[model samples]
Target chain A: MVAASSTKSISVTLRVWRQSGPKELGQFKDYSAKDLNPNMSFLEMLDVVNDELTARGEEPIAFAHDCREGICGTCSLTINGKPHGPGKGIATCQTYMRSFHDGDIIVVEPFRAAAFPLIKDLVVDRTSFDKIMQAGGFITARAGSAPEANGLPVPKGDADRAMDAAQCIGCGACVAACKNASAMLFVSAKVGHLGLLPQGQAERDRRVLAMVNTMDEEGFGNCTNQYECSAACPKTISHDFIARLNRDYLSASLRSAFRPEAASTGGGGA
Target chain B: MNLVGSFFRSSIGRKILMAVTGVILIGFVIGHLVGNLQIFSHPDHINGYAQFLHQLGPLLWVARIGLIVAVVVHIWAATVLTLENKAARGSNYGFKHTIQATLASRAMRWTGYIVLAFLIYHLAHFTLGAAQSATFKDNLKSYVLTADYRVAGFPVVNAGTKVADVYSMVILGFQSPIVAVFYIIAVGLLSLHLLHGIDSLFQTLGLRSNKWSGCLRKVAIVFCLAYFVGNLAIPGAVLAGKLSPQSAKISAPAQR
Candidate 1:
C-alpha cells in the first residue's frame, strides 16, 4: 500500500486511556494529532501526539511498543473496540492512520480483562501468559548433536498444522477480544505447536494437563465456542486448535485415570 | 481429589459434561417426536402405545429419572459457565463489535431459558396433567367409546380403554389457538438452540476436524430444521382442524 504525500496530512482526535500505574483509576484523555501524515502508522501518530504533549508541559502517554513492525505483537491496544484496529489480520503497529477519517474520534484503550492488569495507559502486564508458559510450554530434549531433520519424517499435514499453531505471538489479543477472557486459543496454540511434533511426544500428556491447569489457576475464563478469539487474532490462528487441546486434555485425563504409571514415566526416546 | 470433582471444576471438563448430557437430551427429543408423530395414526394405535409404555412401569420411570438428571446437569453446567464468562469480562468494551458469532449463538442463554420454561409448561400440560387446557382434560374425561377398536383386522384386547388416553389429550390440548401458537414458538426456539448447540457439542467433545467441520455444521442445521418442521406440523395440523380428536377415530372404522 502506498502512502500519500505528507502535504495531505489530516488532523484527528484521539481519546486515549491514561493511567499512572496498575492500581490507578484510568480515564480517557483527549489529544489532537494536527496535520498528521496520512501515511503515518498508528504508532507514529501516537508519537506525534506524545511529542506535542511533552512540548506543552504535559506528561506524555505511556504505552507498550516494540518492533514498530507487526511481528513483535508488543503493541497492544483496543482501537475502537477492535484489537489491532479495524484491519483484518494486522497488528496495531501495522494499522495506518489513513484507515481513519479526518476529525474522527478514535478511542484507544488497553486490552481490558482481569487477567491482564493495566501497567499504565495502553500497556498491560501480559506476564500471566509468561506464567502459563512457564508451567509446561517446553519439551525436554537431550543435549547432543543435532539430529537430521528428515530422519523424523513428520507428515506434511501435521507439520502444517503445527506451523499454524506456532504462529501465535502471545499478544493477548484473544483474551481482549473474547467475551469470556478465554485463554483457550492461546493455550491451545502453544500446546498444539509442540504436541503435534514428534519431539514434543516425551511429555505431551503432561504439557497439556499442566498448561491447562495453570491457565485456570491464572483466573482466565473458559472457551464457550464463540469463535471471537480466532476472528480477532492477528496471527489468524484457527479456533480448531482449542478443540484439539480439549481432545488432548480429555485423553490425557483418561490415560492418567486408568494407567497412572504411563503418565508418570520419565521422558522416553522418540 | 475425586475424578468427578476435578472434572466439574475444569472448564473443558464441564463443557464435555454439557455435551454428553446434551446428546442424551437430543436423543430423547427425537424419540419423543417420533412417538408423538404416532398421533397421526388411529386413536387406538397411539392410546395402545401409551398403554404399552405405562406397562413398562419401573423401566419407564427409570428413563424419566435419567432424562431429569441429564436436563439438570446440562442447565447447571451452562449457568456456571455463563456466570464465569461474565465475571471474566469484568469491564465491558465501550464499543463492541462481534466479528463471527451468529444471532442464534449469541442468544444461546436467552433461548436456553426459554426452552426451560417451555419444558416445564409442556410437562404440566401433557405429562403431569396439572395445566391441562379446558379442551384436553375435559374432553378426555368425557370421552365415550363408540366401538371396539381393532388394528389390521386383529383384535386389540385392551382397545377402547380410557386409562391415561394421551391421544385425546394431545388433540384437545392443541385445539386452543393460544396453546398451539405457544407450542409453535417454543419449538421454533428449540430449533434455534439446536442449530448452534449440535455443532458446538461436536466441537466440545473433540469430534471436530477440518475435513468434517463444515459438513457437521450443515448436518446440525438441517437436522434441527427438520425436527422443528416435524413437530410444528403436529400443532399446525391440530390448529387447522386436520388432526382433531375425531380425526383419530374417524380416519378408520371399527373392525371386528
Candidate 2:
C-alpha cells in the first residue's frame, strides 16, 4: 500500500465559553481552528486551541478530563447544549472531529449546576457528586476471604437491576444537561445498584431513606419527570433506577413509621 | 467555613443536610397543619395551640432560633448552588423551546426565589408580626398577649398568655383582598418549588435511576398538590366565613 505523506484537514470556528473564575464574568471567545485532523479526539482539538492561545500569550482554556477512556467520568463538556458533544455512549475525550463538518461552528461549554462550580473555562468542581454518594451507600459487609461469586444467589431480576445501576461513572453529565440540573438519574443509579443486590439488601432501607433525605438537603432543584437526564445520558441509563429508589425510599419510610422495631432489626441484619 | 463548604459542596453532606433540614421543615409543616386544623376542631383548640407555642418559655426561643438557622442555611445553600449552576452554564439560552420541557423545570429557579420571598413574607406576617393591613394588628392584639417584653423589635409574652390575635390575624389577613391574593400566589409558588425540588434532591444525592424517575416524578407531583391544598384550606375556610374571625380567640371558653 502506498503511504500518504499528507492529508487534507478541515477548519472550523469554535465558540468556547471562557470565564476567569467562578465569580468573574464569563463570555464566549471565538477562534478559527485550522488544519484539524478529522481523527483528532475532541480533547486533542482543544489542545490545539490551547497551543494557539499559548503562542498568542493568552491563557489556555481550562476543562476537566481524566482517564480519557470514558471510565473516570471526569470529562464534562456540553457541545451545542448537549453533554459529551452530541455523542451517545461516548465521553468528551472519545468524541472525534469527524462528527462535525468543516466550517461548522462548535459551541463548547461546561456542564452547568449550582452544585458544580466552575474553576475556570470549561472546568468545574463537581465534588457535590461525591457528597451525594457519601450520604449513604455502604453495606455492613466486613472484609473477609473471598466468598464464591455465586455464594449469594440474587434473583435474576435483582442482578439485572443491580448491573444496570452499576453503570454510572459519576460523570455529572446528566446534571449538566438537565433543565433543573436534577441529579435523579445519578442518584437513582447508586440507589438501584445497591437496592437490588442481596448484599445491598441489608442496608437497603437505610440506603434509600438516607439517600433521598440527603438529596433534598442539597440545593439541587427537584426533578419534574422531564426525563431529560436519561435522554442526555451517554450510557443511556434508563430512568427505572429512580423508580426503584422511590420504592425503596417509600418502603423504608413506611417501615420506619409503622414498624420501627422491625426496621431497626432489618438495619442490624445489614 | 469548611463545615459550610462540606455541607453545601458535597453530595452526601448536602443530602444529609437536605434530609435533616427537609425533615425539620416537613415536621414544621405537619405541626403547623395540625395546629391550623384546630380551627376546624374548635376555635379554642386553634387558640390553645397558639397559646401553647407562646408558652414554650426558653423552648420557644430555642425553636425559633433553630428554625431561623434552618431557613437561613436552606435559602443560602439553595441560592449559592443555583448561582453556581447559572455560572456553569456560562450563557443563557435565548428561548429555545423543547418538547420534553416541563413548566416545573423551566420555572424551577424562579419559583424557588418566589417561594423564598413568600416564606419571608409569611414569616413577617405571621411570626414576626409585620402588619399586612390595618386589621392584622387589631386581630393579633385580640389573641397574642403583647407585653413590654420586646426582644429584637418583636413582641413576646409568657407561653400561657394568649399572644397577638393569631386567629383574627389569620382571618383578617386572608380577608384582605391583597393579602389573600398574595397567599394564593405564594402557595402556588411553593407547590412548584416542591414539585421539582423533591425530585432534584434524589438525583443530586445519586439516589435516582432511570427506572424509578417516572414514579418519583408522580410522587413529587402528588405531594406538591397535597401541600398546596393543605395550605390553601385555612385561607379558603376564612374567606368563606366557615371560620368566623370574631368567634376565633385563643383563650375563648368552649361555646358549647
Candidate 3:
C-alpha cells in the first residue's frame, strides 16, 4: 500500500460513518487515506483504503457502488453534507480526488432519509423507490417487437420535455438534498417520463395517482417547491416535473371522482 | 381516496388547499393595501370609504367571516402539512447544508407564523382601536361630508353626513416610533414570505411550467419588493413628518 504522501501524490483524511449493519449504532470514524493519486475516483480511493484496512486485519469500511460510471444510480454517498459530493450533475463514483485539495478532511455518510434507512456504512436501502415504481404500472405498449419510428407521432415539445424527465437516474440525491426528504422530484420524473408519451396516455391517470400515493405512503415528504432537488440531481432533473405531477394527479383524481359513465349507470343496475 | 377525502388527507390535496386559500388572502392583501393608500388623499375620501364599508354592516360581516375562514383553512393546511413534512424527515442529518433553497423558502413556516401574529396585532391596532392609549382612541377625528359621495358617477350617499375618521387613526398609529419600526419589520418578513409563497402557489396549482417558471420568478421578486415598498411608504411618510399628527389631533372631535 502507498502509505506516504509523495511529492506527486496528495493525501487526505476521511471521516467515514462506520455502521456494522442495519439497526447497529453508527459513529463517524476518522481514517487517514494516504498516498492517493489525484486523478483516482472517490470510489477507487475507498477501494485503496479498504485494501489497506484488510491488510491490517481491521474490518474494512463498507460502501455501495456499481458501474463506477455516472449512469448507474447505485453509488449513494453524501460526501460532506451535499449528496454525491460538492458537484452538480455527477454521482459519488464520478467525484474524483483531484476535486479536493491536499489534506482536506472529507466527511462521508449514506444518503440519509426515513424512507431510505441506512443498512451499513455509506449504504442505505433504496427499496422504497422500487415500491414507488411498482405502484406506477407498465404503460400500454407493443411488447413483442420493436415498432416503426413514426408509428406513434409525438409532438416535438412533449417529446423533448418527456426526455428531460426520463433522465432522472433514481439516485435519491433529490431526497438527500431536500430539507424535508421529499421524494416529489423522483416520483414526478417517472410520472412525467411516462405520462408525456402517446402510449402513456392510456394509463396516465392511474399512473400519476398510484405513484404519488405510494410515494407519500413510503414516508416521503411533500414537495415544498424549493428546487433544491434539481440542484442536487446528478442528471439535473427539473422540478417542473413535480408541477406536472401535481397537475396530472389533480386532473386524474378529479376525472375519476366525476366519471360520467359510472354515475349515469348507477341506476341502470335496477 | 374520494374527492373530499383526497382534499383533506393527501399531501397534494393539502397543497391545493393552501394555494386556493392563498389566492383569497392575496386578494384581501392587495385590496387592503390599495384602499389604505387613500390615506394620502383628502381625509374625506378615506373617511367616506370607511363609512361606506360600515354601511355594508351585514355584508361587511359576511366578508369578515369569509376572510376569517380563509385564514383558518390556510393555517390549518399549513400546520398539518408542516408536521407531516417534519415527521417524514425522521432523523436529522449529522451535517447541515442547503444548495438551491432560498432563505425565504426555508423560513416559510416561521414567516407565516410571525405574519399571523402581526395580523392579529394589526387588527387590534387599527380595526378594534384597542392598541392605542384611551384618550388617543377617543379623540380620533371625523369628517362631516360637504358633498355627495359618488360611485362611478352615481351618488351613493347624500351630502352633510358624518363618517368615522380613518385618516387620523392611521396617522396617529404610525406616529409612534416603536409601532412604526415594528410595522416595517413585519411587512418586510411578510414580503419575504410572499417571495416564496407566490412562486409556490403557482407551482402547487399546476399553473407553472418550465416555460413560465423563469418569468414567474422574476414577477414574484418584483411584486414582493413592490409590496414591501408600498407598505413602507405609509409608516415612512408619517415618521418623516410628511403628514402631521398635530394637525390631525387638532381636528379631532371632542370626546363624549
Candidate 4:
C-alpha cells in the first residue's frame, strides 16, 4: 500500500458498505477525503482513506487483498455499479484514479451475488467457485512420476483452445455481470479446457457432464446466450468457449443415452 | 434429497429440467395448434374436439395436475438457479458493450416471466372461461344455418347449441385493438423466450457437441419461428374477419 503524497490535491466522496460479518446487516457510510494523486491506483486511494481512519482512532475498513497486482484476482469491488471500476481488462488494483474526473462521487460496494457471501466490508466468500472447480476441473494426471513432455502430441488448434479456456482466474466477475447470474461461462471454460485436451480424454465426457451437473446443483442460472459474463471477465474469456462447452455436453448426452459405457470411459482422443 | 434444490443448483439438473420442460411445453403448443386448427374445419369438428376433451373429466384433471407439477418444478428450478447465479458474482460489471450480446439473450429472464404471465392470462381468459362468460351461449339456429351454408366444401357456421358464447367472447375480446395488440406482443415475447431457452437447455444438460451445436441452434431458430407463426395465426385470422364472430361461438365444456 502506498502512502498518500501531499504534492497533489483532490477531493472525492466515497459511499462504502460497512458490515462486521455475514449475519450483520450492512449500511453505507460516507467518507470525505482530499489531497489524492490522479496517478495513484484505486486501492492506493483506499489506503489513504484507511490511514486517515486509523489516525482518527477509527477501525479501518477490512477488504480482501494479496497481490496488489491484478493477477491474484482477490480484490472485488463494485465502483458505481461497475465491477473493478470503469477500466477495461483490469482488476480493481490496476484501476488508477485517473479514470475518474474531479468531483466524482464513487459508490463502492461489495459484490452482491448470493453465492459470494460477504466476509467483512468489501470482502466476500467465493467458495462456491472453488467447489464448482473441485467437482471436475482437474485431469487424471498423477504427480511425482513425470510423463514425457511430448508423450501426447496435441494439435495446435486444440492447444490454443485449451489455453483460451485456461485463462479464466475464477474471479467471479462473470457471475457479477450476468443478469441471470448464470455461471455457464465460468463452468464452460473449465469444461472446455479439459474436454479439448488429449490428456483429459480419460474423463472428458464424465467431467463435462458431472461439472455441469454440479454447477446446476449449486443453483446457478441456465445460460441464455448472455455474453455479459465473458465481456465482464477481467481475463476476457470468450463466449466461444461456452459454445464449445455446449457442443461437448450435447454429444456426451447423446452418447450416454445409447453407449453409456463408452461415455463413461470418454470417447475420442487426438 | 433436496429435489428442488438439486434441480436448480446443479448445471446438469438445470439442463435436464430445462430440456424436459421445454420439450413438454413445445408438445403442448403443437397439440394446442392442432386442436385450434379445427376452427378452419366444420364448426362441429372443433366443437366435437372440445367435447372429447371435456368428456375426459377425471383424466383431464390428472393431466392438468401433471402439467401443473411440471410447470411448478420448471419455474421453481429456473428461479432458484437464477438466484444462485446472482449470488456467485462478487459485483456488477460496468460499461457493458452492446456488440457482445443479442437483445434476446440479455433479456431472457424478463421475457420468460412476461411470457409466463401472458400464458396464465390466456388460459384464464380463453380456456378456463373465467374472464368473460362462465358458459358457452351460441345460437344453435344460427350455427346450423351457417353450417348448412357450405362454400367450397367448408362450413361457414356450424353452431350447435347455445352452450357458450365463446365466439362472441373471442370476437369481442379481439375487437379491442389493445387486446389484439397485446396478444401479438405476447407471441413475440414467447418466441424470444423459446429462442434462448432451447439452446440453453442443451448446454445445461451437457448434451451440446461442437459438431452438432450449429445444427441445434438452427433447429431452435426454426422452432421459435414456427411457434410464433402458429400462434400469430389465430389473432391474425380474427383481425382479418376470416374467423367470423358467429363461428367463434363454438365451445366445449371447460374441463376442470
Estimate every model's Cα lDDT from 0 to 1: 0.83, 0.70, 0.85, 0.71
Identify the runs in model 3 with alpha carbons over 4 angstroms from their true place: A1-8, A140-142, A260-270, B133-141, B245-256
Model 2 residue B20 lDDT?
56
Q: After superposition, how far is residue A227 of candidate 3 from its true place, in Å?
A: 0.6
Which is the leading candidate under TM-score? 3
Error of 4 at A117 (Å): 3.0
Superior candidate under TM-score, 1 versus 4: 1
Q: Tens-digit lDDT track for model 4 on B145-256?
A: 2233233565443445323434445555666667677888988898888787777766655466566878998998998898888877877877886666553434532210
Candidate 2 vs. true structure, TM-score: 0.55
**Reference-based TM-score of each model:** 0.91, 0.55, 0.93, 0.70
First chain TM-score, candidate 4: 0.88
Pairs clashing within candidate 3: none
Better of 3 and 4 by lDDT: 3
Report the Cα lDDT for residue B125, model 4: 70
> For candidate 2, lDDT tens digit of each residue in B19-46?
4565577667667776676666534455
Q: Where does the lowest 10-residue lDDT sum fall in candidate 3 chain A? A: A1-10
lDDT of 1 by residue, A1-270 (tens): 223345467888899888898877778888888888888899988998889889999989887889988788799999998888887788888888888888999999889888888888888888889999999998777748878888898999999999999999999999998878999999999999999999899899888888988888787888878788988898989999998998998888877666434434753444
* CAPRI grade, predicted model 3: medium
Q: TM-score winner between 2 and 3, please give it.
A: 3
Docking class of 1: medium
